[model samples]
Target: MCGIVGAVAQRNIVPVLIEGLRRLEYRGYDSCGVAVLAGGEPHRARSVARVADLDEQVRETHLEGVTGIAHTRWATHGAPVTNNAHPIFSRNALALVHNGIIENYESLRETLRGKGYEFVSQTDTEVIAHLIHSLYRGDLFAAVREAVQQLHGAYAIAVEHKDQPNTVVGARQGSPLVVGLGEGENFLASDALALAGSTERFIFLEEGDVCELTLERVRVADRDGNDVQREVRTVAAYGGAVELGPYRHFMQKEIFEQPRAISDTIPQADSFDASLFGDAAAKAFGEIDNLLILACGTSYYSGLTAKYWLESIAKIPTQVEIASEYRYRDSVPNPKSLVVVISQSGETADTLAALKHAQSLGHKHTLSVCNVGTSAMVRLTELSFLTHAGREIGVASTKAFTTQLVALFVLAATLGKLRGHVDASLEADYVRQLRHLPAALNSVLALEPQIIAWSEDFSRKENALFLGRGLHYPIALEGALKLKEISYIHAEAYPAGELKHGPLALVTEAMPVVTVAPNDALLEKLKSNMQEVRARGGELYVFADSDTRIVSEEGLHVIRMPEHYGLLSPILHVVPLQLLAYHTACSRGTDVDKPRNLAKSVTVE
Candidate 1:
């Protein structure tokens, strides 16, 4: 949830460090800081404000140095205050910036305190600084290597020593860290997006790998202290997606960009092909008899939707698991199952861990649906489909979720064809629907003004309920998640039939009920569910198709969708929910782009 940038250069690197932190602001942070080895001493400036304010503080203080590290921290283990910010120093000898939590910090802090180390901040990261200082033996890299052996949790740290100017040492355990290759200088960052403005060549460090950066060279070492080599790859930069051009917030821009994102994710060919996922996808898909989809957050909801498609269309049994819990519980392993991991950033810690766990259980067929091609998930999987939702800056995902659905739908269609469930006519029909998805998304996005009107009522809501059936049930879950994530509302979702079980008791005049009323087989049952809500005096807001004759009355409100896209309606229904959440959060005056305590890429479990 935090961001880090380190630089070792001949020129003053303060501007570079600040720019990197600015690029990383999308990750969601509460504090920003910069530490520099200036004039044989460590100096730092930290603020519990925006990066712009931190930049102003640095500029006003005239902070300059040849080597430096900067951080934007999303609070964990302590409150978001200046005293708990990063760049925590140790006895004026070393400075460190960390990304993940340290599990054994309490015991380490006690040991350090016993060694006469005084703590100034309420942060686990401060203990790391003291530990490194206590282990210093004239080599910054050696001290960091020794100190990390005692640590017991995920961390990506960059450290600097006053005695060794123009040098930076970076270590990675479970969190992500990268080395940016420059002409005369080298750098370290948590993601390539942070260094996209400076250089494209990067070395993604492996787990337990450490690297030392200087003006002219970069040296890598493994966990056992032996010299190692990491592959260097070039990453393309995001051109205009990084800028907010005429939109009020990144979330709004992402909502409107869903049409383009979906179009780019799917091909307009006459038939779907498994090779689009990877070269070996066809063989792997042929060998798998069962499907296991794993993900977290919004991606997990997308997987839940895919389970319906794989089972009904592809004639394959499928199961979806939340990535955070998949590795913890004991479950039966099937060697013939295809393990699919979905993530927007590809670096989600629990999803990646789950993928590795499945592999450890002898699941050879693995695939990843992700947005970033250079992410750990894509690298670790046997096959991958990269969604072209470029640079999603919003903490709540919009375009990324839609594009992932497109990819999973394609996967479902390809498997159906291979399994003899989809004939030529069915394949052509699937292709036609996919090719028309962009236009369908455009028409759905056109209903924003009406959705905004509904949001006016929802903005006054303290609690809400969403109802959907079959494929749309997952969409309802996603809508509830989006509303609760951005608008600070307590929202819950249940299948339309499940309303009678227990959720119907929560219905009242004060509770707003949002229903996905597509004109499918479940429309009649959904209509009955709406009547149940109406009988309970619950106000109903329904996103219905043009032909689903659900008209608006006193307590019932209906917004007709442009069309009813069979099997593909979930993608269309989700756009309106996104708009509702976005406008509601706007009316509530909450930060739509950077929601509280949520990060764009969840790198820590």
Candidate 2:
């Protein structure tokens, strides 16, 4: 949940390292720091704030060096303070920056303390600096290798030694690391985006691989310190990483881009031409009698939504299972059954393991819907659908979820057409409507200012209820998730018809009920449900189609959407809810991007 970047060059590279850190800031960070080796001395500057603050600090301090390692930290073992910031230094001032949790650091810290090692900070990362210093045998690479050998748990580490001024050492185990190759320089970062501007050529470091980088070359080795062969892959860089561009946050940019992503998936709807899903997947799905979906978090919700689409549209018997729970369950899948896994990162450990488990059970027809191209999940699956959501930075997912839904919807529709359940005209109409989603999404985005005004009431309320019927019930659930994830609000969603059975008891005058009253077959029933909430003295906020003349009376607030887009209305309706959540969280002084106790990618189960 932290960002790490390093650079080794023939000329001063502090500026490049700082720029890289700024690029990676969207990953979420509490503190920022950089350690540069110049004239055989390490100069480190760190601060507890945004990367800008650290950049200002570094500028004020004038830390110039040709070799450096930087980190933007999301605190794990220590509080967010200057002392706890990364680029944690050894006793002699050689600095180390690390990503991932060092699970055995407490024991290791105690061991080091017993040996009279003085620690200046309370971070698990600081232990590595001390360990390297203590075990220094003149070779920075050897020292880092030895220190890493003594360490335990997941890490992507970048270290710079004061005595060894011309080199930087990087190692990875269970965490991501990449080496960017440039003329007369080399860059190291936890992600390719961090090195976007510097170079497109990258050597993706695999698990247990370590590299020693100098201005001229990068040498790779295994955990056992033996020489290892490596392949360099070229990455496509987009200028989007450098600027937000017409959007306030990356979340907003991504949200507005959903229509395009959906459109892209729709055109290739029935054509599974991607090599990731081969003949095996086509054959298996052609003969399969059942389908199983395994996923977690928002991906799991996407699967749940797909279960509805698949069952109704394709007449397929489907089951959606949370990946974390799927492993231990005594559930079984036959060779004639297809297992579909959905994940944004596809590096999510539990989901990846679940895919492996399903494969081991002889379920040969495995498919994955993932965003990352080279992720382990994509590599392991027999077939994969790559979501074109681009980069989703916010911990609370917005665009990725919607894109996953689009992919699933298209998949279901494709299956229906293939099975002769849908006609050519129906397919053409679906594609036409899907193409118009972008413009419809733009219409929804225009409602943000109005939604923000309504957020004033939500900011004061402790509890909220989101209600929808049928397809929109899932949309309501997703809306509630956004509110709770970022705003820290006590929010729940229920099918509007189910209110009488239970959940209505929680309704009171102080409570706010947000209803997704889209003009559909269930519009009248949803209006009745709203009336039920009003009878309980609950204040209401309704997102309705312009034609659904829900009267604006006492204790009621209605924001009429421009038009009714039918089945695609859920995609548009969710925009106002996302805005409500974002504004509420902003007003409450909560972290909208990186909510407390949450990580962007669930790499661990």
Candidate 3:
């Protein structure tokens, strides 16, 4: 995934483009570049390290322009290098910045080479500018359209022509693109955050949509060159609301903010109105007899958790499908079945396509639980539940997963009430407990200091094991995922009972095994599992309820949790793992926030 920004305006566009790229840096930060059409020629500056380096170069070079496009690349097609960076230029120096993959780039490059077009870079993005240069007649829009049609696979492209210095043309197929409306100016970005400071109103581009933007106006067109009308929605810049308060990283801030997000998701206690489901959602769910959840990564884990809640609490048969595998399967959906798509950024290409596939199978009921409001998946779905986790900058999801759980729990409760499986008193009790989750989360966050101490053991170890059972098995998997994602430590999670079966053989004196031993029905079983690790000469770091007293043996390092919390203990137990991962990564000199070869959003399939 990469970030793309373009602006056509009367004012100096360099500063605006740079600011926009700064906001969009979380999308991709491997390499950054900016191309400005100034003095009837494209002037480009780029860096292979960070956006700040590119900003420094921009200031030093004094490349002024009224129109420009910028990019922060994540290095998919080639290595991260100045030559392989984005804002790729044509032979005549017209610049283009692109996001997503060009599946047919190798074939396209061969064709361009036969035409005597010498290439300067190894990026798939470079092929587009050369193709445009070869095919350019007069109309930049026509050239861009023809070039896009020839290209295969996902892309969101922003092109600036040396001939048309005041205009910026953009097109999107599978990647995200947005047009920000401003007075005598227009902004183009892959996300709304890029244009937050510039304008509030934006028009989201759909698949096969193209637009040409000028200082005064913007025009939209379809693939066949027909003028198309689009709905422009106002985007409120709530950037300040996402502040981390006293936390170190957004991941830590969000890890502690889960309770608040949960509370906000379930505002009412007494009301079990079907109207909260929205009209389309209510009608869809009412018509469906079964439900299928499709997602990937952390969202898929959440979907797994939701399957348990839906079947047991809501009394509905449910299935969870991974998006990548679902597409290739012959498994079909019926008209009476519903498809629930879960994605933090509704722009996940596989999940979006899976939603479409479900719809094509005559499944009319499609609902999405997404954090991003303007993402393509949200637009494609019939109904959406927007999570209030704010901007999760970290690649590994912390708050989003918990918030999705809260939303799914509430939805299940609502469905149970609708089916007469639950009563008002029971629903009210769950809602009240949810309201108290924020403060409980704060108490859990207080364990970070202990977690930091526990991380010292991890810093010296090469491998670790995380163990949990029942509903928390998925949470343990998530905890292991967080550690491996940030710390680059080889970690595995298993059901505590399964430790003796196979994973225990990996336990040695050098291994540190972290057990999620919350004071619940499975506490004794988990404690026995910890004993097995200790007997095998394995060091232990246990996160348990303060009330659940266990003998601190020679190899046992026990972290006393706040208290015995029901259903919410998994949420509490995960905080320490996140802290452990962060501290361990810091000690190992690894990039905690931006792990190697991973982007915050996987926009391409």
Candidate 4:
């Protein structure tokens, strides 16, 4: 739910901590702070502004040290203000930043109240700082272990002590924390991406694991005080240079990055062997008679689209579930089913929990389609298909959705071929069609100008309805999600046939209706649905195929795509919707990339 970074380095670690928090800004925070242990005290600066503002505060205060911890707070227990900011001190001995909720903080606060301990801020995290300080016995590591034993909930914490300036202690129970290996420095962060620029070597902590970091070495141990050997693996740097070179916002840049992202996901889509999924892919795909997809947010809509592909193309019985809901519900477990989890950041809390749920239920076959290789999803799953959509920084998700669809499409075709549901000739034809996607995507991106113009009009409206049929229904859902997420517009999507059931009553002159029309068998039916909206005086914003004949009229508006793609049409159709949401958010003067109350990754449940 929050971002944390701690560094013990030879050179000044303040700049490194700032950069690490900068990379994690997409995690959605309300305030930021940094604390450095200097001259037997913590020199700290905090702000209720962006990280840049906090950096300026650090400079103004001259807070400099080689060992420190920094945090970007996503407010949970307290409001986003300076008093509630992190890097909170405890009896002038230690400062700590925490990432998760303490379920028993009220009782802990009451207990500490009688121990002659005074409280400063209304934060659950400050309890940990004081609790650890109360248990101090000369060793910071021992103090943190004792403090964590009394805690009752999930946490990923990094601690720094005034007396132990060269040492940092970290522990994780339910949230993610990693140790970065460097020549003369060691780092701790909630994600490896925070340390991507400085180091590739990392050690990922398991549940109930704790680590002590120093400038010379990193020591990892489990909860029982026994030393543990965690593997140190090298990872590729994530999201190289997240600079807005030409685009207006990160959302705009990510919207335009779809073509490249999709292309990178499947460079050899035409000739890609089934082995792209790793050595066990063929065996796993052959054994599974059913497929279950678990995901959340935009990844959930991608799962919905893949349901169409898996059933029709692969001829497999597929069921899609929202990860958060799926884990809580009691569902039948089919051992033969392949449990697939899709996430841009592999650390999504609900999806990872769902994967563990399926695993605990004895569903042997499992796979993960994820972007971050170091994520919990990849490490826990039996098989994996890694997407090359590096560092999707936008909170609303532009390129990640398209690239996930690309990965799922590849999975469908590969499974179809292995199951004899598709002939080799037809599969070759599908692959050829897939090859046309990148270029087809480029042609589709050219429609942005038209979408921008449409946004100028639609932005004034506060409500919108999206309509689609068959496989494109998921695209319509995603379209509405983008609109509501970025533009703060009340938007809903329904199957075209459901218009008469209820939603048609909401259509009016002030409400714009967006229709996704491809030249499929359901085109005529979708047109009829659009007519119903037009008859209600609802302004029609139709994203039509190049030759669908859905032209512009008085109450109707249209943006024609370059060409018609058959099964891959959803991938192309979504691009314009992303542009529409981005431009509309721009028109309304809303935050496009980092919208209100949304995080790039849901690392906590």
**TM accuracy, model 4:** 0.97
Clashes of 3: 0
Residue pairs with backbone overlap in model 4: none
Evaluate model 2: give its lDDT. 0.83
List clashing residue pairs in candidate 2.
277-383
Task: Give one digit per residue, the lDDT tens place, for model 2 in 1-605.
Answer: 58889998888788888888887776667889898887677888888877888888888888888899999888878898999998888875578888877888989899899889988888888888888888888898988888899878778899988877878899988677889999999999987888877899989887788899998999999988898978888888757554568866666566667777766655554342223255565565688777899998878878887888888878999998989888887876688878999988777767877887888888888888988886767767887788888778788888888888877877787677667777888777777777788888888888888888998889998889999998788888888988998899999999999999999998898989999988889989998898899899988899989999896789999998989987667778887888889889888888777788676776544
Model 3 spans > 4 angstroms off: 240-247, 546-549
Model 1 spans with C-alpha error above 4 angstroms: none
Better-scoring candidate (lDDT), 1 or 2: 1
Candidate 1 per-residue lDDT, tens place, 405-449, comes to 999999999999999999999999999899899999999999999
- Scored by CA lDDT, what does every candidate get? 0.93, 0.83, 0.83, 0.90
Worst 10 residues of 3 by lDDT: 238-247
Native-to-model Cα distance after best TM-score fit, residue 470 in candidate 1, in Å? 0.4
lDDT of 4 at 439: 90
Best by lDDT: 1
Which one wins on TM-score?
A: 1
Could you give candidate 4's per-residue lDDT for residues 72-113 as a string of tens digits?
A: 998888899998998889887799999988999999999998
lDDT, residue 333, model 2 = 61
